[model samples]
Target: MTDIFGVVADATRRELLQVLLERYLAPESATGDISVGELVEKLGLSQPTVSKHLKVLRDSGLVAVREVGQHRYYRLEPGPLDVVEEWLVPFLSVDSLGGGLEQGEASGAFAAWSGVQMPASLRRAGESLQHPSDAGAAVGRAMADATHGTRHRFEEASEAVERKVFDPIRKKLKKD
Candidate 1:
């Protein structure tokens, strides 16, 4: 396998990835795949230059190609990004920003959010509102509780969808 980091280091390749990501997120995108001509036109680059970068991305498994007649379509493949996200999680911790929270607490939050961590400073601020001396603390705590509950529910729903929908589709694709 190509070095994933090295393949993504080029500015053009990153731009290509960004374009694919945008198409993937667009509601009108049926398959989230774009043709080489469309990419060349969108990025205002020569077709050969785009093709070269696309070859690098394809070799690194950052993108997948689908052939339709004589034309080729490309789509972003996000599986490899888990490696980058895992390596960056520690650097993104609240403790790394400043003297805020313990590394373990920060990492725990990152794990809970699957790569995104709630800043330790924010978490501590919420906890500090537990003081009985201020009536405002009661309202703050209530709001915090509601937010936490909502986040937990969202996480649960996401997990359910991944298991019931995406996981099965991935399994079938692999078997083929």
Candidate 2:
């Protein structure tokens, strides 16, 4: 499946995708949608210029456009992008990457929401991110993992991200 990310490997398209994603993901976005005028204003691009990028995203099936009378509203469709996300899961996943934030809380606020008491080890580590001296060591300890089982899976995932997504973007961008 083609994704906005594929087309958005272009800097211009990335800007448009950022606007759409931010607007769509925002809690107060207009109807959870954005109009072409709003996109132009937010991105500081011309209507036709923004429309051109929108067309690319729409054609790639990464975005959907709905027409209400004369205005068109665009929204992100995660299906095509899921291919990219899934492909990059290894490099981005906490389980695979080994040093990233925990599941469900990208900022690592698992204690409050998970109803699981923060382990003293992690609490100390989290507190350490606040201190300049212990920050580096704290981060290292927070990310330590026993490399018993998941190495091969992460290797395969890393390879996929390099081959399928990163390499393609690099090759495409390097073309004359």
Query: Best candidate, lDDT-wise?
Result: 1
Q: lDDT of candidate 1?
A: 0.75
**Model 2 lDDT per residue over 11-129, tens place:** 87888877676667657566567899989987888999999888988899878999999999999875777666544543343332234344443323434555755445455556646
Off by over 4 Å in 1: 96-176
Candidate 2: lDDT over CA atoms? 0.67
Instruction: Itemize residue pairs with steric clashes in candidate 2.
Output: none
lDDT of 2 at 167: 69
Per residue, candidate 1 scores C-alpha lDDT tens digits across 1-176 of: 98888877889999999889867865779999999999999899999999999999999898999999999999999999878765664444434333556555554346467765555755555566656565476546644654555456657987897789767976896899
Q: What is the lDDT of residue 173 in candidate 2?
A: 58
Cα-based RMSD of the predictions, in order?
A: 13.4, 14.8
The TM-scores, one per candidate, come to: 0.57, 0.50
Q: Candidate 2: misplaced stretches above 4 Å?
A: 1-5, 93-176
